[model samples]
Target: MSEQNLSSLTNIPSTEVAHENYLLAKLILEIQQTPDEYLPNLLQIVRLFRESVTMKPVSSDAWVKAMDGIKNPHPVKKAVQQIALSELLRKWEEDGDEEEQTETAEILCQNLEENPVSI
Candidate 1:
């Protein structure tokens, strides 16, 4: 939509984003499963979502999706859900051998020390 059209439309204040935690994940899944021929407007939707979040950062699980999009989004919402999934796999890298776990634990300890508890 044009800037004029966006300005003319009813506005949604930053304090009131109408999306759930996993909404982005769901949307990405749909976009990925959906054939490319049906996604002429996907880029517009993604841009809108990016703007909404930028206006007011929400505690959203879709941050992963955002990161994936940044790293490598499909050609105008063709299907970057796989990218998000690939990023998500980094979480499992921690479940590894003894040396890796110990190194990870050390890093976590150092981070905790750097940012001590504030209770």
Candidate 2:
């Protein structure tokens, strides 16, 4: 008599599958015991769960296609940019020690020298 290969044996149930089965059983029991008025709310939650489980992720191409209609995706007005820079300077001026304040001011001056704002 010859021995069969171990590889030919059927796959055993995984812990994840067993956990899912247990959760489903618990949910079924809860649904049965739930009050009549709350059953509708529970069913809605179940429907939402089902939808979430089946929902597929949007692809990059899909995202590009969806956004193609917009002319300016992120338009930053000149006034808004100026206001942001002023607000940043105001915040730096209000807080920090003298040494730290001087360091920040130097850094800001270096950045402005590197990249001069047109507006």
Candidate 3:
């Protein structure tokens, strides 16, 4: 990725950042649990998922497409994707980190104060 693209990845919306962090962390856990034979593929999937989520106009559609791209002939790959989707849904349904929630609110407030949006 170019430097500009790398910079854009870091500039994801705060709401998306939390989701990305949670997913990445969970992927790390999954990667560790995975057998050596499947580790590389799982890692690649995680990388692709991260890239998809960081794209401009972030949406779940990117994630769904990435998940779908994995070949279905391999049951392990499908299982891993299912697990990731389940974890993502679980995270979204639950109340997230309170500190992160507060930090996001603060950032929003600061942005609003700095650049008031005209009606």
The TM-score of candidate 3 is 0.27
Over 4 Å off, model 3: 1-26, 58-119
Candidate 2: where is the Cα deviation over 4 Å? 1-17, 65-119
Worst 10 residues of 2 by lDDT: 1-10
**lDDT string, candidate 3, 49-89, tens digits:** 98998979747997677666643336776677768966875
lDDT of 2 by residue, 1-119 (tens): 11122121212234544766555555565575689999889989989999999999999998787676343333466567678988987887887678998998899889989987554
Between prediction 1 and prediction 3, which has the larger lDDT?
3
| TM values, all candidates | 0.23, 0.37, 0.27
Question: How does model 2 fare in lDDT?
Answer: 0.67
The whole-model C-alpha lDDT of candidate 3 against the native structure comes to 0.67
Candidate 3, 54: how far from true, in Å? 0.4
RMSD of each: 19.0, 16.0, 19.9
The true-versus-predicted C-alpha distance at residue 62 of model 2, in Å, is: 2.0
Worst 10 residues of 3 by lDDT: 1-10
Whole-model lDDT values for every prediction: 0.60, 0.67, 0.67
